[model samples]
Target: MLKTTSQVRALTPDDLPELHLLLDRDPLVNLFVRNRVDSTRLQARWLGGQVWGYFEDGVLVSACHAGTNLVPVQATRKALRAFAERVLGDNVRPSSIVGPRDAVLPLWELLEPRWGPARSPRLAQPFMVLDRDSRLTPDPRVRPVLIDEFDTIYPACVAMFTEEVGVDPEAGSRSGYRARVAQLISQGWAFAIIEDGQVLFKTEVGAATPQACQLQGVYVHPDLRGRGIAGPALSAVVRLVRQTVAPVVTLYVNDHNTPARRAYERVGFEHTETFASILL
Candidate 1:
């Protein structure tokens, strides 16, 4: 039964133990939150966002990262309702609301009436993970993007972002977007296959904690598609990521993308959970 004294309030560093337990319930799915907490330790001022907790009888029943991304982790229905009410009242403008399918959809239903329609609502995203290498062959050319190749790799990154998210990353300012891409490359998170100054394939370790690293911005140049290049490139990426970045690698794909799913399956990624993303 739902507790009567439940209240939604900002979580603090003192809440770390309980928060860790809650997030550790599904580390792969909750890696974003885990990474945020580990870096900020729930410090309200430094977190660059607020981590709110739903407490019932002094126990944290659910947690929400209310920032650019309105992410809920292990939220109960009661907690979701409380979160929707809180964000609605506060008028929080998150770029997206994303999480496990069960929590995200119900929470969106409560907020949509007031928040209006999303630009695109991805109702089914297969959250997949790989802890070991797959049967697919790894491409020898797949490697970390170098700093000198920033200019060469930037356009491909923008194309991938625009294609996948349906919006131009450079819509606001080209310099800013270019800098972001440069930062990813300088940090050694960006990977690609470059052939004579053209990036044939690209991806990045968007988020990583000690437990797992989440891949994002996966793309193959249009000309390279259907040449049987993606599978081996991705397999090489998975192998490198597991060896150097994290023991396990994870990513979520739009359910309807059969070719992407089949390619990931070839890389030995297995479905672990369902995720929903509402792009605002």
Candidate 2:
């Protein structure tokens, strides 16, 4: 019943339902599904880009997506290696975000030998699920960030990216990282907690599918840490999502981020899986 590795190609319109079945059947990675992962988004990331699939007797079977360089270790490793060997005609590096518990070790096992130990960075990959009925008491200053706040919001995004991921947003400026924030704001997807007009806490839905909204780019100003700002900021975002659309929200945290994990538990997210990101 397994498909061979040769059928992988850019997703076509006919593959949508099958792709959904693949993602939904995955107990460990269901969080990858978001409302934004509609046909258009899926086309851009999985089809327009270099997504590959393995087919057996003309039926699609194993496939791996290479959008962010991170992937489910076991399912995609063989397929990914195939893509690297066949498609790229050389070994390639992929974008990686911290992954969940289940995929972590296997991914590490795959990446460590090739990239060597020093190239690997330890990350805590924690995912959180929300109970829609939960209500977080609001912070008086907490509110949805507005379009007009772009000037301030962009710098906050820059700081968070640089400090957490150690990347300069300036390199991608031409790609409109600022404009992305503005779009998130316009869609009521971004939030900020401010006191005396100074923003203190923030979070955004980094990626999404109909089944879940993923939290990413979460940051609290260092000065405001330990004051319980994240709870309110995150609560507001969850509230918005629960109120407007889906009943559940999910986020991944680094395993070492005890503070963040603790904060997420306070808001009602439970531990799910372990994942790893290896550079190969």
Candidate 3:
């Protein structure tokens, strides 16, 4: 039966232990939240927003990271309703609602009436993972993007973001996006294959834990999309990432992206779960 006695409130540092336990339930899928908590330790000054916890008779059963991404952690049906209530009551509107399909779908259903008409709702996203070297030969040319190659990598990233997300990231934060790309390169999280002065293939480790890491900004040059650059390049990524970043590399792609999924499969990534996103 659904627990009747419950309380939902914004979490604090004191709640970190329970929060950690909850987030650890699925580290690969929860890497983004885990990374944020590890870095900020639930500090609002750093987190920029709150993570709400759903408690049943004094035990944290689930949580929702309310910020640029409204991500749910091990959310139950009851928890989703409570979280929706809290969000609406406080008038909190996140840029996106995303997480595991089971949790994200129900929560969005609860919020869509008021938050109705999402700008872009991606309902079927395959959450894929690769924990070992790919069967395909790694593309030897793909390597960590050097700081000097910032000019070469930046345009590819913008194009990928615009094509994938349907909006130019530079449209909002001109400098912010550039700094992020630079930061990822400096940290050795960004990888690319550049020839002369052009980026042929590129991707980045968007988030990570010691257990696993999530990749984003995967792209193949527009003019060269059909020549099968993604799979081999990602083979290189999986190999290098397993050696340097984490054992498991994960990413979620829209279910409709056939070529991307096929390329990921060619690199030996298997679909482990379904995720959804409601972009606001």
Q: Best by lDDT, which number?
A: 3
lDDT of 3: 0.92
Number of the candidate with higher lDDT, 1 or 2: 1
After superposing candidate 3, which stretches have Cα over 4 Å from the reference?
1-3
Model 1 pairs whose backbones collide? none
**Candidates 1 and 3 compared by TM-score, better number:** 3
**lDDT for each residue of candidate 2 in 146-207, tens digit (9 for 90 to 100):** 88887777788889877766567677564667777877788777778756656688877666
TM-score of predicted structure 2: 0.82
Shift of residue 201 alpha carbon in model 3, Å = 0.3
Per-residue accuracy of model 1 over 1-280 as CA lDDT, tens digit each? 9647989998888889999999999899999989889978878676878999999888898999999799998999999999999998888989899989999999999999987899999999999999987678899999999999988988898899899889898887889788878877887899999999988999999888899999999999998787888889999998888888899999999999998998898788999899999999
RMSD of each: 1.8, 3.5, 1.5
Off by over 4 Å in 1: 1-3, 44-46, 173-176
**Residue 84 error, candidate 2, Å:** 5.1
Error in Å for residue 248 of model 1: 0.7
| Candidate with the greatest TM-score versus the true structure | 3
Ordering by lDDT: 3, 1, 2
TM per candidate comes to 0.95, 0.82, 0.96
